[model samples]
Target chain A: MSLASLAPLVDAAAVGDPQEGVPLALYLAVSGGLFLLGLLGVLTRRNPLLLFLAVELLLNSANLALVGFSRYWNVTDGHVFALVVMVVAAAEVVIGLGLVVAVFRQRLALDVDQMSSMKG
Target chain B: MGERIVFTIAAASALSFGTLVVTLKEPFRATVALIGTLLSVAVLFLLLAAPFVAAIQVIVYAGAIVVLFLFVIAYLGERPIVEIGDRLGRYQAFAWLAVIGLAIQGFVVLATTQLPGVRDDPKQVGDIGSPEAIGRSFIDDYIVAFEATSLALLVAAVGAVMLAKRAVKSEGGR
Candidate 1:
């Protein structure tokens, strides 16, 4: 098959409803996948910094879905919600990084497994 | 067609960078990858007709928060210890499965709830992209939230300085 012939198939796989000029399903799927990846990272990674990044990814994935849905519904509420989410996310990152700094200073490490003193 | 192409590129780049953010072993590389993800997300925001929010995403998240993350990673230096063990157990597997199932069920419920005659409308792309519009709306409609956010930022700044100071003082004492 010619490369040009295969192009449509590839595009179709990545996006649905070309006539609509938007790929709602693809956006939703990718956002959900990103969220799952972040969730797995949080569950599996030992590094606190990586965990923090993963948490941010999870938040961003939700934000993407919110914006996508808002566009699909033709409403401004989704955009407003996304803005609020970003504000909350910023606050979260500040506090989270601060905590990481405090923990590292005390123990000289970022390993989540080693910080088990508070597990009791 | 141009819009579709832009959406495809933005979505692909965002997903790829997001994956790299988690998979990269070096904290610094992962932080850089996260910045890429944020930039891609900002592009997505613009494509969605939210130029104002997209600008804020770039300025606040990509510009400030990510720089802070990089600084933290750099300041910590290289600790010999790295990987932590898996925190999840078998119960977590079931928990995740249940959550996914519930999410799918909820989506089905919502999809079914749409009115029979409802039709998708073309987005009314507003003049909301202008700084004037955003400023006016923010001041008039969201003034309380905006002021609260400023206060929160103030508290965060003070708290961050205090946290860093304590660390410095303790190190000096030792």
Candidate 2:
């Protein structure tokens, strides 16, 4: 389906009255799909950059689920936790990128498969 | 309303760009996609009623972190050389399936279980959105964590400088 249609459905699930709108089941399904896509990227991709992107996707999926639950319950803690997760994600990207640069300088390649050769 | 529309757009952008970050063969394209994803995620944060976080997401993530990624991508050269296979091995596939299954199960449980409902008290609403309120709360409730985050940033700066200096030395020697 088109993403435009999916938006209303997701919004309805997130903010609609408990009885109507998109069902929680559907929201969870979408989250599951995203998580699976990320997992496939991580498992199949050999590039460290792509692997990190997959990791970010994994985190974003979790954030989506968190926001969905928060909206359903009408609380702010999930939102706060999502904020914390974002901060941690930013920090992770910095450190991960640094490591990537260092590794690339040493090995002149960005492949995760080649990183296995750690004979210094 | 506008909020919902903005949230939808942001979420879609984040997802599509995130996918591109992984699927693009060129590391430069991946870095660009990553930056787009981060910007969209910051917008998502704004939709969630956390403006402070949204600002931080833009400033720290899109601004600083992504620049770091781009620098690395540039330094490593922008050659599109990485080859990707279509499918993972059996064990990896199984592991991915298991993770997805577990996440779905957890979501189902949370959706079905009768946990304490979300508290929408006026008091809770009053303290969450404003920058001043967030700052006050951080200082009051999470002082140590906040301080630690600052320390971490300091360390990162130092480490980055060290690495740059080493690179300069090695290049000069060559």
lDDT winner: 1
Per-model DockQ = 0.29, 0.23
Instruction: List model 2 lDDT by residue over B37-120, tens digit each.
Output: 768766755555567766876786678766766776677775544554423344666766776787667555534544343212
How well is each residue in A1-120 modelled by candidate 1, as lDDT tens digits? 232432443456554545545545556665776787677667666678899899888888888888777667665556666777788788878878887888876765677777778887
Model 1 regions more than 4 Å off: A1-20, A23-25, A73-75, B82-122
Best by TM-score: 1
Which ranges of candidate 2 are over 4 A from the true structure? A1-37, A60-87, A117-120, B1-4, B78-92, B116-124, B165-174
Interface alpha-carbon RMSD, every candidate: 6.7, 6.9
TM-scores, chain A, per candidate: 0.80, 0.77
Model 2, docking class: incorrect
